[model samples]
Target: MSYAVTARAALFTLATALTLSPPAQAAVSADCTESSITLPPGALYPNGIARAADGTLYVGLITSGNVLRKRPGKAWETFFPGADTVFASNALRLDERRGLLWGNSPDFLSGGKARANRIYALNVADGTLNRSLALPAGEMGNDIVLGADGTVYVTETRGGGILRLRPGETAFSTLYRDPQLAAPSGLGAAGIVLLDDRLMAVANFGTGKLYTLSYNDPKPQLTEMQLPRLIENPDGMGLAPDGALIVLENGILSGQGRILRIPSPKAAGMHQLEVLREGMESPVNLTITPQGCAFVSESRIRHRLLPGHETEVPDSFRLYQLPLPLTAAQ
Candidate 1:
């Protein structure tokens, strides 16, 4: 089943029966001795996460569309306050070379009630809003990845296409669109990355398939990436220095997320999947540091609300760090 369909069923089956309680104050871990960065429970609904070169952590909250950051050995602080216009922040991409951090706000939290569904960029140094461009009608901005030439490529989960913004351009133009790209319920595309100047890859959350598009093609054409097996509910994606792909499986209603490391699509068809971690609680997005360590956000969304009931979430949300030297299936 597609996320869009599952979401509708959940809202219909649970919205009326569940009476949400006041969110608990965020709980931070007393110990930083571990690899993971613990979130305050009150920072509920974290989806988009990114890291700066200096190790500062940035996270976007879906509940309030607020952005938060934490420096090394410091506590999490609100970087961008709640906004009525921005509904939910999904995937965040940090452009270290340009000193900008881009955020995807598809209005998922508002159920599309937000006045503007757009992609916004912030000054990484001070968290000031730099640019906000509204997406075309029927599109929900989901993931963003920067090209080598500074072009921004974004996925439209519902709109069933990709939009592009060239360097120094204020407005985004449609790069590609195909109804077949949309999920069964019409909202499908998720994670995306430009492997290099020529190849681009995307994950279909609705069908659990990875696809590739060539920039050199006169017309954008997408072909299913050959994987050893299906990756159920793939969301966030990242590229390793060695050219391997890191994929996050934001597990279906179960919240049992996992991560995968795979070679480039050009390497081979149906290559074996290397599982980096498993049994996570609704892991959303991830980013890697130059030193090779990766950070992942655990949203635990299902714990807060089931199809027929609502329960209190943990006192704090959590971001776990997986040390380098991640092993793959031999």
Candidate 2:
């Protein structure tokens, strides 16, 4: 399911039950000034964000279908040819080794009007389209990640599975699918990241739990991750230098977001939960830079769409550089 649909449903259910109020200002990271570069004017609903090894930042617009780029200390500019193949850019991941920027375009809001869900690869050097592959009709391509061996994996938000495109392939095939990943109403299997070459950590937005899968086996083993506290709507994730998992959580039905740093998979089910930041509006994506800094997109799109919560967001959205205590693992 899409965040737009999820917010509308929650609005209908909780509009009468929960009191809606203006969002409290979140704390900016003290380590670094909460300094941020604004997206290009009209680049509404910024969703997915990724940073290249060269300190360039790329942001995807969910509504306008535009991808914006900014270099350190520079203003944001429209990337590439501008929404030629991108319909609804949701998640972006950079394959630095190959100089490619991968994005998932799912028509959650513009369904029927927009094109089908697609996985697009663009050359970061010149912002030229490299490859575009359409998924099966009706599949929602929500998030993307690259494997250590150059394999590409994408999350099917509604299909409850992962789609894979090997290094030299132009088409994607179902890598894994199971009922456990299916959501009752909203999204299931929202975010995914490779813990290593063999193991993958996935977030189930519908159920609010994490699962670990070993992709090396023909039929991989999938197990629920036992965390000290469950992450509600875990959308995007990254790894820390010490192997901890950093998760971006959209609050449970309230659009209040948070960032969590949890113990490494070696500790697995029982590990301390570290709250890196909280009180974000609707953080959807997360990325770590080469210098070990963490950045997040405060989309706030869901909060604005929810009925009573429309007045809670600001005139514009923002991207925050978090003051994480750890660095990206070498």
Candidate 3:
């Protein structure tokens, strides 16, 4: 169905139930990690997930119109929503210092001349609503990333481009506006150590293509990575400390959803491996910690640990997690 329809259902169905729960607490494995915590009853189907410098998980729900956070050993908290000063939170990003959490407003949820999608900067320490950045209205804010120097890059859905916002600037300029990013969806910046050079990759939600920028050349060159046909709608992306690239299939057309792992995007005989997990209904974003923790968020569920796939997630939607590989890059 269309985004609006799904959102309406999400808002109405929210708070009616917990939706999903872990199979157990001590389980460990890519397919069996139990959930440490489940999202609130009203949280919408979550999409993009970003971790704060403090290490809390920030998940954006496209329908429920809020960004939910889960602290280590604590229950999930819904911080910002469309009802507040700004708008509904969609895509997510973090400051270079990991101090702030930013979520995109993706206009698909709210129709208006209102500032398209906005990123609400959240304080990880207190779960307080901080500042917000606004983009031109009607442009769907997809995924976002911060450069080493702290420049912020956000992708636009139908705008078919990426916008660059400096550390303290409000107005954003398109970094790359070609059709290749026709549906510029998910985005993540790789540390120089991860890809030999600081790079940023954006997934095309519509084209099933991968776009990469080598470095900060005035004009960023784009490269494409081929994927297995099974992963047609590439949504979000994550990188482990060792540089392994983890991709999430963001669409829910065929069945529910799927998560795929590619050893490395550096191209060294690496093949796509499908990660078997349940409750993936529609996996949006993923974050791999240096400690071997793979945190994933479904369109609706809160953040959970890897091997969290076995948790009892609703067939309609859910999230999963697994232990990241120690030698993920080599």
Candidate 4:
């Protein structure tokens, strides 16, 4: 089925029974260990994360559309506030060379406002809007990744395609689209990571499948990766320095979220996935630092999506940092 059909079903579901009430406010859990950074009270649902070279972290909230930032030894502060244009922020990518942070602002929960989905670029030094590029009508922007040559790539969850915006280009063009990228029910492409200028890894949220796209030539080749077993709800992903694939399985309704590490994802044949962490609330996205540490954002969206769980939304959110099991040769 096409994304349009699935999106209509999702919107209808959200409109009727899944409309959630305001979450109850509370304090951060005392069990939040030192490895985790607690978000401010009522941070809502955080979905995306980006880390800078200086250890500054940026997190994007899905429901509130606010972006929070934290320095190496400071508290989390609001970097960008929700606005009429940016109603929902999804995935985030940092373009360090350009000194910009790129994010998706989809109108997923805007109640059929027909607003164009946006790919926003913000100044990394300060949370100032650098540009807001509108996507095609009916396209839902989901994930973002920057190429080595300053090209920006985004996934269209509702359009079931990859969109590209080259440097100095004002409008985006469709890079690749296939039926495998679309879901019959829920979201389609949810996470994306560029392995290099020629290749990218994409995860399907609805199908829980992984695919690698090679854009070296005019015709991009999409290949389904063979995995050892079935995965669930792959949301955000990153490429480890050691060539491993780090992914988050955000259990939107089932509450079975986890983080997985797949060694040598580019290798041929079946790849074995190792569970690095499990029993997370609703992990959404992650950003890997050069020092082999990964910070994961737990959106906890199940509280809003599941019936009778509205009050279960935590008062504060969190970003947990985990050390990647890299080789000792470094």
Each prediction's Cα lDDT score?
0.70, 0.72, 0.56, 0.75
lDDT score, candidate 1, position 170:
87
List model 2 lDDT by residue over 1-330, tens digit each: 146354534321221322122222233235445455555656777778888766788988676557889887888887854465677666888888898888887776554675677789889888888888889877877778888777899888776888899988889999899777767754778778888778888887766678888877889888888765556677888775556687887775765688777656645446555676778877888787544478888787775556676556457778888655553333
Displacement of the residue 172 alpha carbon in candidate 4, Å: 1.1
Compared to the true structure, candidate 3 yields what TM-score? 0.73
Best by lDDT: 4
Q: Which candidate order results from sorting by lDDT in descending order?
A: 4, 2, 1, 3
Instruction: State the lDDT of candidate 1 residue by residue for 31-73, as single tens digits.
Output: 3223667676578877788988677888987666688898888
Ranking by TM-score: 4, 2, 1, 3
Worst 10 residues of 1 by lDDT: 12-21
Name the runs in model 2 displaced over 4 angstroms: 1-4, 8-35, 111-114, 308-314, 327-330
Off by over 4 Å in 1: 1-34, 111-114, 303-305, 324-330
In angstroms, what RMSD does candidate 3 have relative to the true structure? 9.1
How many clashing pairs does model 3 include? 15
Best by TM-score: 4
Candidates 1 and 3: which is better by lDDT? Answer: 1
Considering lDDT, which of the candidate structures 1 and 4 is the better prediction for this target?
Answer: 4
